[model samples]
Target: MSIAIKGGNIFQNSRPFFDEKMKFPSLEELTIINLRGIAELWHLANVEDEFPAFPNSENPGDSDALFNNKVALPAIKHIKMSLVDGLQKIWGSHLDVRSFNELESLDIKFVEKATKAFSLDAIQRIRNLKELNLQQFQLTGQFIERVGFYNDEVENSVLLPQLRNLKLDSFPQLKRIPWRELTLQNLRCLQISEIHDLTYLFPASICKRLVNLEALRVYDCHKMKEIVREELGDANTVEVKVVFPHLNFLRLSNLPAFQSLGSDNVILEFPSIKEVDFDKFQNPILWDLLQKLKPVKELQLGRCESLFELHDLKGRSSTMLPRLRNLTLSYMDNLQRIPWMIFPIKNLRYLKISYIHGLKFLFTASMCSEGFAQLEEIHIQDCKDIEQMLAQESIEDTSNNAAPITVVLPRVKIIKLYYLRSLRSFSSENYEALEFPSLEEVEIKEYDKEYFDLNTVIKKRCTTRLCYAR
Candidate 1:
């Protein structure tokens, strides 16, 4: 049975909301919200033998047993406690974790002193714990050894062998976790954010332990320079490759000190990864790493200041983005051009570019020489120097001027242009025209929201939808 206490002065000094003669029996799920009392009413379920439910203050026979009684929740599996501020201790004196044999999931947020609430001994008692999330606790010190601190099991046995998911955020004192030294055979998902001191996510000992890990997210770790650290001191500078065989999603953002996954000597591979998003200053090592991974369906790269222009696809033999579908580029101050023609890819459907000050054009004339996207939407915003969509390069050689080709975006339905201060036309003087066949809507937000004939620019500069598109 599941019971949720919505609103009340539920527990005032262990005088639970339940009146006299009421018993909490066969309870499985419990939720308490905004109850300002140190007594967690669920503790009553722990005491095997029935105790006086609550002191009947009006009756002389009722005795106050608040401090003397200790309770254990053996049947409760899932627990969510929110806004119960008066809780002096969570797994403290009143609650006994040894009886929490069936506890599976615990989520505690926006509470104070939650770090000291549950003693390390209490956490080690639950053998079946699966998920633990601690947020906004501002915790310090070795919060829990089971969360990958001590390596030696004889000293501190791996508490939750069944634990699969763990999230720790906003811990400033946490410099590093001893995950590599411990054995977490089943732990798969790990997310650490706002931890400033962590220089690297995994050391040499822990990288290989994540055999079941699928997703890794590290955010706002300003001092974090690498996702994984490579071990050294071997032969003539040998490199080690760490492969996350089942990892599918990886997101790294707001990490100012963040650089590459590892040094050029160490290689990182994600064979099953499908999506990757990175917002960091440009590190050539990162670009070099992407060439070796499985083709991603969604790729976003932003806030990279060192990337002046992407010149890798100039004559690369193998196409890197063979399975790309959605691409976004933002906050790239030094980026000048995207060599769209550099790769032989056609799966792209949506494209967005914003906050690029040095970009003079979106694509080069070389890009139009090849194929175009089966695009549905194109959004270009806040670009200070985007004078043209497709840049034109004047070629003097007659052999290069064999024909004037038209590139068509057949299914373009929505086109949005905003704050493009130096807007010109879509195409340059070299191409015949760039065409959008199925254009339905065009929203242009400029200094003056005046009616501008965007269709006229398309008709004169860009090619209309080709016969196949029509």
Candidate 2:
């Protein structure tokens, strides 16, 4: 039920890979890789006599009439093709629809010369397709329109009605995606990357149609200005509320022109989102969006040059990020320190910081005395100005009774420090050693031993494995 062909020039003379006389009743999966000089895949010798269901009709009715009884590969479910440079067409114009009616998944990658994957008529017949991935193709707007509906007025007409997952990547010439013309209610995952000419993603009319979308990731789009474009209708038009009820994972990275999701006329909501990643983003609007993401558990921010601090956290209540367990900050040269007062430290388990040039220390001595009860891992690397892990400070008291307190890290198990040239000690000179009841392993690389001693940082009775490199 499976056929695989790789690295061959067998069908080079404008011939079909599957001849008209061939009939495959039980073939289910087909994979072709690194094939050269292949012009076409399927062939039908007689177009009028063999398949006569939709001869003169513009709109085909009754899905059963599209399939021919004698069609080859009648039960095929999956097809994948990669690195087929010379392939011009997937199938002939008059090929029988039964060969692809049962197909569920189709993936094509690195087929640069092929302008389109399937003929307009052939794509509409594959009603059972659930997943489609096209990468490194030279397709344009015409290819997208060909796969979509030919006539919008056709009653109850939709293209790829059963498709659930769709990915389009590295299409440089593609400038627009006609979301309003396509019906994609069943789509769950949509990812688009490296489409340089695209200026915006979704128009206002297409938001309600993507009700089932769970994951949306757009990366490396240099010109994208908004995820959803604001449309101004007549004065009678009511306010628009854009909501993704089931979406949980969202990542937008390396988008320089992106400013906001939508304008003032639109209300944005992501009720089920749990994870968010933002990198190389420079906009104050991002802070407004983060204030609404109270349910996000894992957050990663990197290379945001304009960010000097968490400006929104300065005056807000401590209830922000109540569920956050993992946090990563990297390549932020202007950031001075972590705003510990805004973080819900009891729920934080993992903390990673790297390439932060301006930060001097991670926590204050008073902060360490409170203990990170649930913190499990600490990783710090490539920080040029960091002098210590904790800064020496006395606990604030109103009646002039301030006192130095003992540092307690009750649950921390692993500590990793690398390439921190300015780091002198774990804490300032006041605390000779810190309590590490659950410490198991410590790793230090490229650190100066003359400035700080390992014996002065940890208690001698604590049995901990230490790994040190030059």
Candidate 3:
């Protein structure tokens, strides 16, 4: 039921790969990769005899007269083609609308010569399709326009009504998505990457209809300025409320030109979001969005130049991210210190920091008593100015004499420190009070042996592995 052809001159001309008499009623999946010398997959010699209603057909009824005739690959459900240099068309003009009605998934990549995936008449009949992934195409917008929705006097018809997932990547010629003309109500997941010309992802008209979207990821888009463009009336006074009720996962990375989610006139809200990832973003608008996301549990931030500090806590008793559990920070060029007052240290379990050039220390001595009590793992790397893991500082005390503070990490199991050029000791004062009751493994790399001894730093009685990379 499945056929894959790769790296060969299997066919020599524009002839049909399957003869007219050879019927593949059970062929469900077909894949062609790196094939040469083939212009058309199915070529009918007499076009008018097989499809009398094909020339001016726009809707299904115009071709209904030829539906009774036998069609090729009637029950095919999946098709994928890649690196087919000479493939100009997948379905010949002679085929009627009912040829590949059962198709559920189509994946086409790096086939530059192919102008269109499906004919206008053929696309209207693929009502059962669920997934479509296209990448590295020249005329991507033209192909999408041909398969777009059609408006009839009686009703508005969608081209792919059953589609659930759509991904478009490396579309060099696509400047914008024609959301005003197309309707994908059932779409759940959309991932786009390497689209350099796209200005915005969605318009206000289509945001209301995407009620079922669960995951949306857009990365490596150089010219994308906004996730959604604002819509204004003739008087420029109307405001739009855009909400993604079911969306839970969002990732935006390597988008240097992105400024805001939408203009000031548009209000955007994501009530159900739980996880977010942002990388290489240099705008303060990202912080504004984070202030609105109070329910996030897992957050990853890397190379954000605008984030000099976490939102100024302003002496608030409660933390901003009360539900946060997992956090990762990397390449934060200007972050000099971690504001422990604004972090939910009691709930944090996993922490990783790397390439923070300006960070002097991670925690102050006064913060060690209650901070990171539930933390399980710690990883620190490439921090050149970190003089100590925990800075020595005095806590406010009523009596003149106070006992030495003991730092207890009751749940920590693993610790890794790499390439810390200025690290002098585990703690600024001494390494005696630190206790890792659940200690498992400790790894240190590229450190100066003259500064401190590893054996003196880790004295836990539990089994542990100490690895040093020179």
Candidate 4:
């Protein structure tokens, strides 16, 4: 039932205090609509020119007490004051709001001129304050360099220990995260967005301090090259615990200079980490880190063009993922082939390979290779040289019993093939013959269809549906 008015005007006029007081005594709400687009107002100037002192009054008129004169509203739970500037000196020094204690929320908007120093004396006075949002405010750490603004410059580093959510945006000048002084025992979510000059916030050693932090996002910070950099390169020696153990989702994107996940110098272990998404890392280092970290169900590596070979099992390379269920490798221009020799996993259910312009083979295994029994779904798209899933070779009857024609499909159910311009044929009989008994469906998607007669072949040989789409 309450309404608000905007763009209205209220002129500066002096009046006897007793005249209008009795007229509007019983009025519940009074809105002094200011239509004037005046930007600057001072307490002394308003008191001297607008409202002069009473003829024989002994007490001086209080400019800061002006907000107290508004009509009282017992039902008012929220108040929004806009277009008010230079409020730093007004509330920072002498505002008294003990009577408005019942008010739970206050929103101050478009006050860009307010100094960051003003909050030191003002915020602590609001005893019942639960939530606060500072938008487009010119706040800086140097603003409260002394006098324990929040407490000490050390005390100034105060976190709403009770606060559960916080959002800070477009603050390019914010240089440091006061993690040392701020107490965030109950903080659950934090977002820092669009800050370009933020070179560093939390030191590598302090990532363990945010114990209760569940979700954190640091996005579009162009200047920050790494999260925990010093301990990440190939040569450091430190013990870095997986900071944010309770974190379930983490996104590090568009950071062009991001090199590796962690410093090789440190023994970094992510015991509780389940998801990681990173782009533009050297292949050797990327795989090395993957070998060191714990098993995650899903992993995505993008735009690492330098990765020519998946695993150099020829030397000290690691084994295949035992816990991976879905793996996607895309846009790896130099990847010549996937070295399945090092893979120790026979449990992979779904695998997708795409846009590896140079990728030649899915594995070095012959079609009759029994080592790949657990593979169920294979999706190959946009690969330039790979024309087929497996080569066909007829097996001669060598068993003791009479020849039994049977396809063994213990797991595979779906297969997809697409966009191999150079793919003249899928699995020609020239190579070793292969057999799949569990495969039930095959989908071929591409711009050219005549070169691949997958539908006719699947219907006659595999006895499965071969869906072709251009």
TM-score order, best first, reads: 2, 3, 1, 4
Per-model TM-score on C-alpha atoms: 0.71, 0.80, 0.80, 0.60
lDDT score for residue 220 of model 3? 96
Ranking by lDDT: 2, 3, 1, 4
Preferred candidate (TM-score higher): 1 or 2: 2
Q: What digit string (tens of lDDT, one per residue) describes model 1 on residues 347-390?
A: 67788899998898876545644555677878899998887776
Write down the lDDT of every candidate, Cα atoms only: 0.64, 0.72, 0.71, 0.50
lDDT value for model 4: 0.50
- Give the winner by lDDT: 2 or 3: 2
Clashes of each: 7, 0, 0, 17
Candidate 4 versus the native: TM-score? 0.60
Q: Where does candidate 3 clash, by residue pair?
A: none
What is the Cα-based lDDT of residue 457 in candidate 4? 39
TM-score of 3: 0.80
Cα deviation at 195, candidate 1, in Å, is 1.1
Least well predicted 10-residue stretch by lDDT in candidate 3: 58-67
